[model samples]
Structure formats: structure tokens, C-alpha cells
Target: MKIHKEGFGTIITSTIIAAAIIVPTVLLVMPLYPVLGWITVIAILGLLVFILSFFRIPGRQHADGEDLIVSPCDGTVVVMEEVEADEYFKDRRLQLSIFMSPLNVHVNRNPVSGEVTYSQYHKGKYLVAWHPKSSTENERHSVVYKSGDKEVLVKQIAGALAKRIVNYLKPGDKVKQSEEMGFIKFGSRVDLLLPIGTKIEVQMNQKVKGGVTVLAKW
Candidate 1:
């Protein structure tokens, strides 16, 4: 597995902090209370490991097809329902949401190959990922991809623990299916607004991998 580019700064900062704390404990505290010093070392090291693991990009072949809509992030599906469109479309749509925990991979991928027709960021409240209002009220970046006659909107939403949402696409940019679109720092959720009548392949509460699992078909 390769570490993502987004983690470099964070990893460096964490390494510095760990060394600062570990060095003093080892020199001054370890000689007095060996057990406590060892515990401190272990705890700091474990936390550093978790930070590294959060940005890991595992090696795997991604799914791709013209009519297939792949999952944009690794998480468990928390919602699959038909709801009235509120933002861009202003019509009915099938909304599918995946909830990503702090332990889950945070990389977001493009679900289809097409030109980006809309890319907008919204500033809002940070609600818990599973809350019904979080989809609209939470901080988010929305992107719409137009492939032929179909257009799909994908939203990267920030949860209570997530503070940064990174998106790399803009209107008029061409994107391919399963390509990296952004990264969400920490825990969050992703919402896909699909055109009504789209065939759904995944079920509620199902686990999915970014760029690997087939979510639906055009």
C-alpha cells in the first residue's frame, strides 16, 4: 500500500510531536519509572500508526464500465431512498449515502467518466454523518458529472469529526471512472444523487470499497 500525498504534512507533524514527547520521556522519565515511560512510548507509537493507516491507499484493481456507477469511498451504506431533489437538479432523485468511519479509507473517487458540469463547495454546520439533516446542513463539496444524457451529483459531506473536505475537480474537466476526485480528512459521509429510475445494485447497510464496488447501473 502507498501513502497518499495528502498525508505527508500531517505525518511529518505527527512524527515531530511523537519524537519531542518520546525523547524527553526516554531520557528523563524512563530512568525513574520504567513502566510509565514504556507505556507512554507505546501509546504514542500506536497513535502514530493509526495516523499513517488513515492515509493508506491499498493496491487493488478498480471496477470500470460505461453504464456502471462505482462507489466513491470505502464505507457502509447508511441510506438508499428516493427523495425530492433540493440543490442542483430541483427534481426527484434516488439518494444513496455511505458513512465512512475514522477507520475507513477516506479517498473519494469519481463514479463515472464524463465532463464535470458542476463543482461547488458549501459552508455549513458539521452534524453527525448519520443524521438526516447532515446531508444538506453539513459542510460539503458537490460535483456533477455528465456522461451522455445522464448526470449524477456526488456530495462529499463533513461530519462532526471531519473538518477538511478536499475536492480536485472543477466544471469542464474530464474525469474517468474510479479516478481520484478528492480526500476527506477523518470521518465523513458521501451522498450520490442519481437520476430516478436508475437501476440500483447495492442494498442498504452494505459495505463498499472506493472505486471497486458497483453501486448502480444507468
Candidate 2:
């Protein structure tokens, strides 16, 4: 597994702290409290492993096609229904939401090849990933891509545990299907609002991988 570049600073800082503080603290306690020292060592190691795993970017083969809509993030499909979109579309749209836990990869990807037509970031409250109102109330970066005659909107939402929303694209920028779009630090959710007539390809509670699983075909 490859470590994502986003975690480089975190991993380096953690290593330095372990060497400067944790290791020496363990050594000093080993003689008087061997068991406590060993436990501390294990906890520290576990934390490092968890942090490393959180940002691991596994190799992926992006599903490429002009009409294919790939999963934008790894998680279980939570919302798949028609809803009134008040932001960009301001009309009824097919909404597909992916609920990403801290354990899953936090990277976001483009679902289709298109030119970004709308991009905006909103500062809001941090709610749980699975909360029904999280998609609308949480801090999010909204992006819309226009492919020929079709347009799709994707939103990166910040969850209770997620503190940062990193988006790499802007309006007028062209993006390829399944290419990296951004990364949501820690846990969060991704929402895709498709045209009403688009075919649905996935079901609720089904696990999907970013840039791989097909969510629908436009």
C-alpha cells in the first residue's frame, strides 16, 4: 500500500515525537515499571499504524468512459433517491450519497470527464457522516461538471471527525473521469446529484471504491 502525500507531514512529525519523547519515556520507565512501559510502547505503535493506515492510497484502475459515473469516494452507499436540489440545479435530481468512515480512504475522485462549471466552498457545522442533514448543513466544497449536454454536481462534506476539506479543481478546469478531485481529512461524506433520467447502478448499503465502482451511467 502506498502512503498518500497528504500524510507525509503527519507521519514525519509522529516519527520525530516517538523518537524524542515516547522512546525515551519508555526506556526510563522500563526499569521501575516494565509492564507500564511495554503497554505505552504498544499504544504508541498502534496510534502510528492507525494514522498511516488512514491515508493509505491503494492502487486503482479508473473506470473510463464519457457516460460512466464512477464512485467519487470509498464508502457504503447511503442515499439513493430523488430530491429537490436547491443549489446549482434548483430542480429535482437523483441524489447518491456515500458515507465514508475514518477507516476508509478519504480521497475524492471525478465521476465523469467534464469541464467544471460551478465550484464553491461553504463554511458550516460539522455533523456525523451518516446524519440525514449532514449533506446540507455540514462544511462542504461543491463542484459541478458539465459533460457535453449533461451536468452533474458533487459535494465534499466535512463530518464531525473531519476538520479539513481539500479540493483541487476550480470552475472552467477540465477533469477526466475518475481522476483525483480532492481529499477530506479524517471521516466525511460525498454527495453526487445526477440528472433525473440517469440510470442507477448501485444500491444502498453497498460498499464502493473511489474511481472504480460505477454509480450510474449518464
Candidate 3:
């Protein structure tokens, strides 16, 4: 396992805060209110652990195939349906949405190996990740990947608790399947717009791991 690069600043800040609280509690509070001080210490440590866990990247063999599209993030599949893509394609597409909870890993990966053709950031409302309208209404960074003749759009959307979305790929950049494409701070959602008539491999409400779960096939 490895800590994500994105968590360094957060982890450092949390450590400082934890130390500030723990040192004072141990020296001042523990001398007077031992139980309360101990409780405070445990609570602060637990929160710090959770913060570290959020950025942990566990080692695993990622799924890969020439025609397969892997999941781009860890979460539960909240939406799987056909919809008219209004932003980029402006055509019919099969949409798959994954809702990332605060407890899940928030790193986003590339679903396929291809050249990035479109990358754009949209400023919008911060709706809850699982909300039906959040896919289009929430602030998001969208990227389109082209492999051979097939193209797919992936959107990193900000949820109520997620205030920042970090995307690394831009137009013309070559990305590999299951590689890091971005990271969403805190909880968020990811949307994939696949070509119509593509075979859907996962079902709604199914849990998926980024770079590990097979999402579809071309």
C-alpha cells in the first residue's frame, strides 16, 4: 500500500492539528480530567487515521484488455442508462455513473488507453453524488478518450462534500488504461458516457474498484 501524493498536505496538516490537541490534552487535561483527555486523544487519532486511509492506494493487479473499459474510480454504480449526451457528443450514449462515498478511495483512473481529445472543466452546483441530477448539475471536469475509432467521455463530478476535483489529462495527452487520471478530494461521483449499443458489463448498484473492475467492452 502507498499513500497518494494528493494527501501529503492534508495528512501533514492533520498531524499538526492532532499533535496540537493531543499534547495539550496530555499535559493539561490528563492531569485533571484523565478520562476526558484519553477520550479526546482516541477521537483525534481515529480521525487522523481515517484521513490517511482516504488517500491510501492498495497494491493490486489492475484489469486490462484491448477492448475492455475499466472502472475509473472506487464506488457503487448509481446510474446505468441510455441518455442523450448534451455536452460533448450531442448524441445518444449509454451512461454509467459511480458514486464515491467519503469512506471509499477517491482516486480517479483512466478507463481506457487512448489519446485525450476533449478536456473541459465546468463550474456548477455541488449536488449530492447520488442525486439523479448531479451528473449534469454538479461542478465537473470532463475528458474524452479515443481508442481506435471508439470514444468515451469520463466526468469527475464534485458532490456535496467534495469541493475540489483534480484532473491531470488534457487534450492530446496519451493515457493508459487504469492509470491515474485525477483525484477528487473527499466524496464525489464519476460518469462515463459510452457509445450507444456498447455491451454493458456491470449492473446498477454494483460496487466497483478503480482500475480493477471491468466496466465494458468495445
Listed per model in order, the count of residue pairs whose N, CA or C atoms clash below 3 Å is 0, 0, 0
Worst 10 residues of 2 by lDDT: 18-27
Candidate number of the best lDDT: 1
Local distance difference test values of all predictions, in order: 0.97, 0.92, 0.94
Better of 2 and 3 by lDDT: 3
Better TM-score candidate (1, 2): 1
TM-score of candidate 3 relative to the true fold: 0.98
Model with the higher lDDT, candidate 1 or 2: 1
TM-score, predicted candidate 2 vs. hidden true structure: 0.96
Question: Candidate 1 local accuracy as lDDT?
Answer: 0.97
**Candidate 3 regions off by >4 Å?**
none
The parts of candidate 2 lying over 4 Å away from their true place are none
Order of the predicted models by TM-score, top scorer first: 1, 3, 2
Per-candidate TM-scores read 0.99, 0.96, 0.98
- Quote model 1's TM-score: 0.99
Q: Write the per-residue lDDT of candidate 2 for residues 1-218, one digit (tens) a residue.
A: 79878889989998887777677767698888998888888888898899999999999777888879999999999999899997989899999999999899988999999899999999999989899999899999999999999999999999999999999999999889888899998999999999999999999999999999999997
